[model samples]
Each structure stands twice: as C-alpha cells, then as structure tokens.
Target: MTTQFPTPANELDRILTLSDFNVDYSNFDDQFKDLAKLAASVAGTEISLVGLIDSYTQWIISGHGMEIQQTPREETVCQYTIMEEDHLEIENLSMDSRFQEKPFVTKDPNLRYYYGIPLKSEGHNIGTLCLLDRSAKKLAPEKTELLKIIAEEIVNRLKTYKTIELLRHKVTEVTDTKNKVVHDIRGPLGGIIGLAQIISEQGKDNNMDEVLEFINLIHKSGNSILELADEILSAEKKTTVKVKGDELNLRVFREKLEKLYVPQAKIKGIKFTVSISPETETVPFPKNKLLQITGNLISNAIKFTPQGGNVQVNLVLTARENPNVLRISVTDSGSGLTQSQIDNIIEGTSTSTEGTDGEAGYGFGLALVKHLIDGLRGSFNITSDQAGATFEVILPQ
Candidate 1:
C-alpha cells in the first residue's frame, strides 16, 4: 500500500520546539539507552528505540538491540505515532495498511510488531519510545502502562536538558558582558590617569588655573565611568524584567523555587529550605519577574553564606491590611552585611561583593529587587545583625 506520510497539524511549531534540544541526529545517549532497554524488557520485544522525528528524519537517539541511527520519516512507523495523543501499538506492522509498504517492514528488519509511546514536550509530540519485534505480539495492559511512565521520564529529562542549555547560554552572555565592560572602562580610566599625572608634574609651577581645569576633567572622567557601568548593567536588566503577569499557583511556584535553589545550595554545602503558608494558594503576578526577584535573593544568600550554613525562603499571606498582602522572605545564616553595603542597597547603587568562598558576585542584587518592588507597588525590607540577615518583600493583592 502506498499511503501519504502523515504530518501533525502543528508541524512547524513541533519542529521549532524540537530544534531547541540541538540533539545530534545519531548520538545515542546512555540515559535514554537505558530507558529504551527497560521499555523493551517490559514489552518483551527484541528491539526498542527512542527516536525523535523531525521534518524528514527520525533520529534514533537511543536504541536497544538496534544499530540503525536514523531513517526517512516516510519509512518510519513513528511518523504516525506522533500524531496520536497517547500510545500507538500495532500488533503487526506488516498487516497495518498505514505501515505495511514502509521499507523497514517490506525489506530490511522485517518488523511485525510495533508499540510507541509519544514523547511529548510543550503540547507537541516530538518523538517516540517504541518497541519492535520480528514476530507479531500484543502488549499486556500493565506493560503498556509501564511504557507510558518511561515515556514521561524521557520528557522530564528533555526539559532538564533544555534548562541546562539555557543556563550555559546565559553564563556565556554574562562572561561576554563583563569582558566588554572591562574593555570599555579602560578608555575613561586612561584619561583620568593621564590628567592626574600631568597635575603632579605641574604642581611645582603654581599653575592654579591649569590644575583646576585638570581637576574638572578628572571629575568628568569619573562620572563617565559610573555612567558606563550603569548603562551596561541596565542592558543586562533588559533580559530579566517582564511586562506581563500570570495567575500562578503559589504551591507550584514554591516547589519550583525550592527545586531550583536546593540543588545549587547543596553544591555549596549549604542547607536550603522553602516554606509557604498553608493559606496561600495562588497569586496574580509576573512569574518571570517573581523568579528573577527570588532567584537573586536566594542566590545572594547562598553566595554569602559559608559552607554548612543555612538559607531559607518563606511565603506568607498577610491579611492585616485592607488589601491582602503576600510576604516573601529569604534569610541566610551568614556574616551580616557591612554598613557601606547597606547604604548602597538603600541608595540603589549596590555593587558586587565577593562571597565567603571568594565566588565573584553578580552586581546589582538588592538594587534591582528594590526597583522591581517599587514597580509592583510593594515594599522591600532588610534586617541584619552580627549573626545573619533576612530580606523581605511585601506585595499587596
């Protein structure tokens, strides 16, 4: 049977999202290889494959008992699997009109049984976790459920992989930004240095007017340095700020924050905790901005705190005022902030400071948080002593 190759209605979107993985068409990752092996074991099949199908190719990312890396989309049974919302199992691929004439079935491999669970991401079926066998057979109900669970695991891994890729890209951006800022600062700095050197040499001449002119130039150069720093930092800010908001479940939000920071803290030998009041359920807020705010606070807490220290995130619903308020706090068991740092934070000009472990700081934490809080018509507070510190945010609902 010669049938037209089936394509999803969201083919363009599906392909675009799939490209985010940047996966090598033939690279068989071991994590996915294990998943394929398990899938095959559960289904009692000779061949199990984890394949991602794109416009014209089915990239066999991982497979058990199969060496073929990829195949033409039209020649692959998985082409039809991605179209369905759930698992697609064909007891006999040779008997199924949709796949009978496919090259893999009619010629090489001569596969007779097929079962595929769609690998879904962002509402699109990007690939499949499939099992194939030479002899016709049916998969048991329990085995099919197990395959579905494995498929979900594959999707979760994909999400985590994509997130890691994004973080790597952001790190690159930050490194480049810092490099550019350092290079650009040299121009004004050189001017100031040259002017000061000239003044020292001319001091013996009692040339008061020339000295004053040099002083003015030096002052202007100093201002230029500050302005340049602000310009570059503001440019970085553009990537983080959001203009829109979403109705987000607070429970999910808290869990996500904990998941993100807990691992980071653990890497530094710090204990991280997130606590939300039981009454808090949902909030109307820009999710990304909230993430940015909390992320910066938690990151600073972890960075400043020494090894074996503690960091915490707290979310509370406050009902004492006319409009209900959402209170979020991040506390760290670390050396308290210096008076100079506190003043800079209050003046919205806080600069980076090294952590206890000598980790280089990312400039502008509390200042940015203050700006975001002001935008939200909220309040930001900080309290610190000889022992530790706590940063609080109060948003009225």
Candidate 2:
C-alpha cells in the first residue's frame, strides 16, 4: 500500500529559505554519547542517534553503530518524524512515499524501520532521538516507552546547556560593569587623597581646625570609594567549585569571621561569640565558599542585631549512613524576621529589610549566598523565635 503524506507548500518554502541553525554541539560532553548508546541498548535497535536538525541538514551529535555524521534535511526521515507532535514509529519507510526516495533510505545507513522521539525545549522542537533497523520491524510498547525516556533525557541536557550559556553572558556583563566602576572611581579618588596630603602638609604650623576637617573628609571619602571597589571586585569573580566535599577548617574560618565582624558588632554595642563542637572544624567543603556563606551570615547578624544584644554562631558535625555532614548556625538577638522574610529566604527571593541602624542593602548578598550554597550542593534555612533569627547551613562533607 502506497501512502501520500501531506506536503504543505508554504511549510516547504519556509524550510527552504531558513538559514542554517548553528549550535556548538562540541560543548556537549560524554553524556550525549552515553545516552545514545543507552537508547540503542534499551530499544534493542542496531542504531540510535541523538541528532539536531538545521535548516538544510540533520547533524548527529551522537550515534551508536552509525558512521554517517549528517544528512540533508530533505532526506532525513527524522525530519518528517519531528513535524508531528508525537513520538513516531514507521514500520517501513520504503513503503511510505515521503521517505522512500530519501538518500538516507537508499544510500549510506540503508534505513528501513525508524522510530523517532522529538526533543523539545521551551516549546521549540529542536531535534530527535531515533532508533533505526536495517530491516522492517516494530518496537514493543516497553521499548517505545524506553525510547521516549531517552528523548526526555536529551531535552533536559539541552536545557542545561542553554542555562550555562545564559550564566556565562551574565558573568561577562557583571565583570564589565565592575571594571567600569573601578576605572571611573580611581581617578577622582587619587585626586582627593593627593589634595588631602598637600593640605595637611601646608597647615603644619597653624591651628588648622578647618584644614584638618577637610583632610579627614577626603580620607573618609577615599576609604569608602576603596571599599565599594572591593565589593564590586568580589562580585565579579566567578564563584564556582570544580570539586565537591573538600574539607575546610571551620575553626580558623570561625575565627576569621569573628575578627571581621567584631568591630562592627562593637559599634552596634552587640556581643559576638562562636561555639563549635570538636568534630565540626574539619567539615568538608569547597575552599572559599565557606567564607562567602559565613561572611553573608555574620554580616547580616551584626547588621541587624540591636544595641546590647548578642549574636552567637555554632557549628556541629554529625555522621550519618549516607555521609558525614556539618551544620553551622548563626543566631542573632535582633527584632527577628517575619514569616514572609523566612519564606523569601527559602524561596530564593530578593526580600530585604532595614537593619537596626537603617542600613540599606541591594538585596543581592543573600541571593548570592543562596546561589553559592546551591552550587556546593548544600542546604540553607532561616528560623526565628521570640529571641531572634537563626540562619543555618547544612553541608555534606
């Protein structure tokens, strides 16, 4: 029996005029290859392919038992398969007018039976996972389900690739903004510092109260500008970890946090203390990330704690059947967070509240802290009671 598949002239025209879609498939690592092999194994097919369709060709990103890397779009049976909104299985393409004359059917791979599952992302159909056999055959229901599972995996991988690309663009933008800020501030800051030095020298023999005030103003302005530059620099650096479960010395980390926040705490008339169980000191973590996490917590604790209040940090290590873990907590004696604030922290939103001294924040620090913790595959939580709020981080060793 001969079947005539509907070929819409307008659709053909659009496809013909469309420019070639260029994607950097080389960036996809061994996962694609593994998926292709697994798909073929699960389907019990001789050939399996993870292919991407451009305007004029279908490029095979990864294939099992297939030497042909690409074929003309007009000749790829998978092209016809993707046109439909469902997974397709054709018992014999040679009996179908739409694919019988295609080069892939008569030439290289000598395809006969074809089953394709569309790979889609963000509502756009990008490619397909297909199994091909040299002879006409039908896939069992279980095999068909397995093929669809593999297709979903391919779609997930594409989504991940797109996410990484977006993050790279954002990182570049942040770095550019940081450089511009530094470049613009350096000139004015140097001038102020130089003029202040000159004024101090010239007023050496006079009562010089006005001169001294002017010099102090300039000095303070320079210091503020320097601090702003440092924050921008820190923000521009990529906070990614290549290795997980690397041990960090919690003892030294807590000491550094104490020293950094003590002066600020004292200024607010707040008492700061650190308490840890013996085993917590050698908690495994990516280096420097502990600093980022602890810095945000300690800074927030000091910023929000009221006068004559106290802020205490505690660390405890525990061993479980799954893995060893460390739990770090920062407790503050402040007005305490609202339920909404706790929800926002857990939900990863930009919810900011004024500090005791009306200090303002850009709502970026906690978001950055959350992002860093997620990167380390850790968990964070915020809890509050009558006394205050406690921020906790649980990290796998």
Candidate 3:
C-alpha cells in the first residue's frame, strides 16, 4: 500500500528557519554517543541518532554514522517522523511518497531505509528515535516495540535532569536566607549577653535583690536564644556520615553519657544508673550518631523522672538470628507517657508535656533523635507502664 503524509498546519509555523539551525558543535559526552551506537547495533542499522528538535534545529545529542554533527530542522526527516502517531518506518525511501522528492534523500546522502519513533513526554511529542541504513530492510514487530521503549527511557532521563536543576535552585535560596538571619542575630545577642554579665557582677558586690533578679532573667533569655540558634543550625545541616555496622565501646559511651547528664540528674534529684553486660564491650554504630541518639534519650529520661526517682540505662550484646546485635535501653521512673505521645514522637509536631518539675521545650529533641536513628539505618521502640517508660535502640553489629 502507498500513502501521502501531510504536515500539520499548526506545526508548520513552529518549524525552525535555516539561519537558526547551526550544527558546528564540538562538545558532546561519550556516554550518550555510546548509547546511540548501542541502539544502532541492536537495530542492525549503519546510522543511528538520538535526535532532539529544539526551537531552532534538529540537534543530534548523540549519533553514529553521520559526518555532520547537526542539520537544519527543515532538512531533518526525523522532525516529520515525530508527527506520526506510530513508528515511521520505510523499507525504501525512494518508493515512499513522503521522501521520494525530498532534497536530502534525492541529492545529499541518498538515503534508503529509515525508521523513527517519537520521543514523547507526558503525552507531548518532543523528538524522534531514528535508525538509517543504506539498503532497504524491515524490522520485526518486537524490535519496533523495543525502539519505542528506548525512546520513552530517553524522555524519563530528561525529566530527571530538569528536576535536579529545580532542587539546586531551591537549595541556593534557602542557604542565602539562613546566612542573612544568622548575621542579623549575632550583634543583638552579643549585647544581651554582655549586659547580663555586667548586672551579675554588680549584684555580687552590692547584694541587691533587684539586680540579681534582673541578671537571672537576662541570662535565661540569652540562653534560650542561643539554644534556638543551635537548633536552627543543626536542622539545616545535612547528614554527613553513612551508617555502617562498626563496633563501638558501650562502657566508654556510658561514661561520656554520665558526664552530660549528671548535672541535670542532680538538679532533678534523680539517680542515674548505667549497667552493661560484661561481654558487651562494643556494639555497632557511628560514634557521633550514637552519642546524639543516646544523649537525647538520656536527656528526656532525666527531664521526665521526678526528684528521688531512678533512671536506669543498660547495654547488652545479644544474638539475633544467630548474628550479634547491640541493644541499649533507657528506663525512667516518672509519669509515663501516654500511647499517643509515643506514637507522635517521630511526627514533626510538638508532643512535649510539662515534666514533674516543669521543664520547657518545643518537643523537638525526640523528633531529632528519631531522625538520627533513621539515618543510621537502625530501629528504635518505646514502651510505657505505671513504673515509667523504657526506650530500646537496636543496631546490627
């Protein structure tokens, strides 16, 4: 059967002009070139092109068996092939009505067999997947399907590249905003801290009650601002370390924990205890992340436990599925958290209730701890009862 293919009127005006089609390009990546070559080999064709029709020219992003790097859109047979709803294949262009009189086929390369598939994105035709051969040949039905799949893959890659470009632009905007806020905060914070120090010194000499009160208020306000700044900085920083199941010293880790929690434990009248199994010397973790996870747990334990209540921390190396894993538990004697609180710990919202001693926080500490544990590729769980709550963190060793 023979048929004549007519160009769509709407697209005729969108076609590129000859002057705008420039092909003298030199920079092209080897990987794309190799992909085009692979496609040519699979189709048993001498020439292949991963062609993209931009606003001006039908640019060959990657190509094989072509002397010129690019060509004018008006001269690009692939441009017309993209308009076809299905693969445009011909065993002989000389006999095809669409190309028998075309200048390129009659005068230039004297092309014969040609097959082109539309490279489509989101139902819009973008370009063509084309293969060329000197002699007439017909492709199997399966090969035609495979060519369509390859064209779709190319469109997927282009979409991914555009998404990454958008994310980079967003990250740059966020960084610039954070820098400006930090700069504005530093000067006023310094003055507040300095004034508080002066008031504290004056109160110490005169023993004036009003001066002492003012100094305490100023100190508390400054500390609150500093904590806010630290949280902002910590939240902005991306995770740098990858989780690996490396051994960490549990005994030494508990010692460092004691140093961090002792003062808070004293203030709350809580007795802190750390117990580790004799054989449990090391457990798998990134040391800094372990510290962050444990620190948040211990701080929460100290905060919730009432004065004279006991908080016990335990570490054990146990066999799970015949492989060693490390388990750490923090048990506190305080008003136990409700089931809802436990469920909401990983939620981004604040779930903090006032401690027995009224410790104030935005309830972000546990949320941050959960984020760190997740980054370490470990699991954490919580249980509550009348005696209090217990938190267990387990990591593969």
Clashing pairs in 3: none
lDDT of 3 by residue, 119-141 (tens): 76544455777999878899988
Supply the global lDDT for candidate 3: 0.67
Off by over 4 Å in 2: 1-22, 207-397
Query: Which window of 10 residues has the lowest lDDT sum in candidate 3?
Result: 16-25
Among these predicted structures, which one has the highest lDDT? 1
lDDT of each: 0.74, 0.69, 0.67
Q: In lDDT terms, how accurate is model 2? A: 0.69
Error of 3 at 135 (Å): 2.2
Residue 171 error for model 3, in Å?
2.2
TM-score of candidate 1 against the unseen true structure = 0.50
Judging by TM-score against the true structure, name the best candidate: 1
Q: Write the per-residue lDDT of candidate 1 for residues 246-307, one digit (tens) a residue.
A: 22346766776775566668767999988887754543333435655676688788878999
Model 3 ranges off by over 4 Å: 1-31, 95-110, 197-397
